[model samples]
Target: MTQNIRVVVVGGGYAGVMAANRLTQRDDVAVTLINPRPDFVHRIRLHQLVGGTGDAVVGYRDILADRVALVVDTASRIDTTGRTVALANGAAVGYDYLIYAVGSGSADPSVPGAAEYAHTMASLEEAQRLRSVLDTTPTTAMVTVVGAGATGIEVAAELAAEGRAVTLVCGKVLHPYLHPRTRRRFAKRLAKLGVSIIDGPDARVTGVSRDAVRLADGRELPSTVTIWTAGFSVPDLAARSGLTTDAAGRLLTDETLTSIDDDRIVAAGDSAAPSNLPLRMSCQAANPLGAHAADTVLARITGGQPTTIAIGFFGQCVSLGHGAATVQLASKNDIAKAFAVGGFLGAKIKRDSFPGLIEHLAHEAHQPGSYTWKFRDDTRRQRLQTLAER
Candidate 1:
């Protein structure tokens, strides 16, 4: 006799999937997930995809809840007033509540010739394109990886491990999120693997050509294939749809993850900027943000008020090929600590994190509330909540 509540979640990444799975806690709620790709992209292993060592996709059926309907289509626009989403396939999906989790993609580089010549590997399609290009080029081609973040380091190491002539064109210092001690350890490991790293005050990329990359120091490196992994850029769906957004284009939300314009609309994952203070854009934060987004919607539906959002931060893990990794230790506040772990243990933890991500979604799919209980860090949450208030 009760009316079914309809909830729509966009983007099937970690946050979207987790939110969809947890919404299954109520039989009266009908959940729908909209994603452009049929297969869920295991983002952490995207470097492996480019290196041809592993697949970066997993079937949605493997992790999504049975109760959630999967719609494979690109969302062109969101009609908040109508509570409907327009799809590229000329279809529309209606929702009583909407969760915006359309994660992020490689940033559009501004350096002259970089956009025209450089390649990026932020999505499955981009990775596959780079792989195809790699296949055609000579083995000795000078491969330049621009950027020193986790993606850049992983890509550079993966190629070097495969015996490719690889150069890491760090814009500045390497692994800026890591401590100086850990950065040194990573540099040594990379050097041992034969990766040419160019990093200094004037190491920023200035331009890119068909066969060379120019640096600010007036040096030009012969680069047959230039890959850009500098930063992430979110989709402008919210802005295109006339919704309020931060300077970075993320949907601006309050502590409850609800949009400033509409309580019926909430955001999570990389595209969510909460209280102008979003957690780092990573799968680690996405999983918990997803779960909490669902909780807010459920609370509103049942006449319970949604509380503040609090997510913990675990430092970064950069897999240096199959041989090693740098699991940077960090405080709950997400600062990298001096102590680090790697070699075999870091490799083990990084390997497990791949399936570990899927396991969280599967657990919530089979048993709705288990994710929040098993993975929630209460002490860290309290700390983050206090930070939000201030």
Candidate 2:
């Protein structure tokens, strides 16, 4: 009898779950998925969680493959030489192949007192806590949302729509990923919703107090609550295990999604930096990366060559409160395009797709190789290659 291949996937985020589900296609492989939480966090809807409009989570049973063994535990370290992962619960899981899909979280900002006083919507717990804070806050309480990225914009809009006095402190520019015309429309919507937009060189947050926020330009904003959505930082498990990683601590992989240091180790999602050219950290990329990682493992097992990574880009969708959004069009390489869909149409896209994301995952679980996306653009591919060479 052939020995069964043991594939251990760490982190139960979108990428890890997709990889686990896809790996179940083969009978000869035993896939074990490790996650700290019992439920899957719909990170894209975390702003809704903060706004009290959504829960931002789905049970693993709803999306994960029934055949994939679930291990609820936290990974402390990866012993690559020993091919074992040490768990926080004092157990270790040995694997013939490892998939690193540990996703990202709220970055530790340099601003003083922000870590202690500010709220971040990086995880389900954080979102829940923010919700609780919002529950107690007066409708007219001054709430400052730092950063004008997707999370900040969404949270500010949602809260402002609920009658909270919301201020959006844009670090440098508002919706930098958006075209100027779409940005103008988005800004108008926010203003119409009673959200104050602070943009300029001095818009950067410098400090957070118990009830206030200070900007670089000596502007002190009276804030009863502060929400930080500035940047993201990944877990340090890869770096702690001494694996080769980028400056941000994401595991370095080749085009095939296998770790450069160890062929036995594969990487996907926000935790993976392939060829030093990682796609944007979004579900748009994570699902594909996860599917590709599983394909690579299966290819190796069947003595087949794995395909090189080729990911195309789609545009960004930003929810401006509940009934409005901005869908910025993009080229295959994710460059901003002039065309955009806004208002009710954009809101419909956001609302319709939020629930469909899980359904899409469930479909992948049932069909294994059912997930697919846009092919990579040649120009972008060549440009990335040039960057890698340099």
Candidate 3:
């Protein structure tokens, strides 16, 4: 009789949960999922939570496969050579394969006083805290949002829709990823919603105080609440675990999603840096990468033919103030294209896509093997050639 394969997945986010669910479907494999929290945070809904538009949590029992064992402990250290994962509670678990899906965190604020005063919507707890603060605070309170990325825009718009005075501070113009036409549409919507877009001279946040945000050009914007959605940075666990990682602490993996230094270890989600194709830290890439990582592990274990994973982004969606949105279509390579939709239609598209993605993930978890697609060898070859030239 063949020995049962043991797969340990760290982190309960989208990638880890998906991987564990898929792995549990195989009777020959025993899967253990480790996470600090019992509930799975719908991280994508964090901005909505902060804006008091949605609940930012889902139970693990609702999504985790019945056959998979849920370990409620934080992964303190990974011993790849020993194939053991050390938990914070001093329990060590051994595994035949390990999946590291520990996602990234909100980037550290480099600006003086920003870290001390600014609240982030990176996690469920932080979002809830921000929401609580917003709910209890007076309606006339001034809120300042630092950054003009998708998260920043969404949060600012949501707050503005709630009749709060929101000032969006962007180092550059808002929605740089969007086409000029879309940007103008968003700007107009924000303006109509009474949200102030402070670009150029007032863009940079030099300091954050209890009552205001100091700009780089010596302008003090009165703000009772300062929210930071600037950027993200992966955890340092990858680098500390002796894994080959990029400067940002993302694990360096090959086309197969296996770490370049260790085939037994695989990485996905925000923490994976696959070859020259560094995917962004979003649900768009996380779900696909989770499936790819599971497939890679299954291929190696079952002695099946090896396959490379390729990712192709569909488009970008940014939600403006209530019932408004901007959808920027992109090529498979993620280049911005001419096709775009905005306003109510775009909002509908954004809202519809969430449930669709959830259903797709549920389907993939239930039937893992059926989702495999032929590897794009042409794209792989092109990526390799580009690397060589570099």
Candidate 4:
């Protein structure tokens, strides 16, 4: 009898879970997924969690494959040479092949007192903590949200719709990734909810205190609760484990998503820097990467050649509260296009997508090889070829 292949996946986000489920295609493969939290966090709905609009957690049993083992522990280090992962609780998990999908979290705020006072909503605990804080805060108190990315916009709109005195401090242009027309549409919706929009270079946060936040323009806003959604920072597991990593600390892999140092180690999701040209860090990109990573590992296990990754994006959907949303159309390469969708239709699509995403995961759990995605991006292909020529 042939020995079964043990593939250990780190991180239980979309990428890790999908990869684990897809690996169940072969009875000879055993998948073990290790996550810090026992439950899965619907990361796109984190803003809803913070604003009391929705819960952002799902039990792993609801979405994870029964054949896959779920380990709830933080990965402290990866012993690449020994093919083992060190856990925070002083345990070691050995594997025949390892998948690195350790996703990202809100970047630690360097603004004075921001880290100590301002709250983040990147994880379950953080969102719960922020929700608790907001619960105790008086409605009359000012809620200041820093950053104007998709997260910040959603957060600001969600709170403002709930009658909070919300001010969105855009470090620069509002919805920088959206086309100018879509940005205007979002601005109109936010205004309708009485959200105060403060954009421009001078709107950047310079400092944060218990009851106030200072701006770059020398104005201090009376902010009872400050929220930061500025940027993302990936866990340093790959770098600390002596693996080859890019400047941003993501594991460096070839086009096949295999590690440069070890063929048995594969990478995907936000923490994967394949060819040092990673896709945008979002669930949109992660799902396909997860499927592709499992394909790579399965190919190697079967003594077959793995194909290069070819991922693309549709666009971005930003929820503007329960009543409204905006879908920014984009090309496969993620450039915001001129046409956009807004209003009730947009909100409906956004509402259906979360449950739809969970159903996709559950479907894959029940039937391993059933889920497949459309993948063909001539733009991405041309860009990679150009990079190679240089």
* Pairs in clash, predicted candidate 1: none
lDDT, model 3, position 118: 92
211-245 per-residue lDDT for model 3 (tens digits): 89998889999999999989888778777778889
RMSD values, in order shown: 2.0, 1.3, 2.1, 1.2
- Tens-digit lDDT track of model 4 for 243-326: 999988889999899999999999989999988888889988888898899999999999999999878777899999776788
Per-residue lDDT of candidate 2, residues 262-287 (tens digit): 98999999999988778788887888
Give the higher-lDDT candidate: 2 or 3.
2
Clashes of each: 0, 0, 0, 0
Instruction: Itemize residue pairs with steric clashes in candidate 3.
Output: none
Please provide TM-scores, in order, for all candidate models, with all chains considered together. Answer: 0.96, 0.97, 0.94, 0.97
lDDT against the true structure, each candidate = 0.91, 0.89, 0.82, 0.90
What is the per-residue lDDT of model 1 for residues 171-199, given as tens digits with 9 covering 90 to 100?
A: 88997999999999999999989999999
Error of 2 at 278 (Å): 1.2
Q: Which runs in model 1 stand beyond 4 Å of their true positions?
A: 1-3, 373-390
How high is the lDDT of residue 239 in model 4?
91
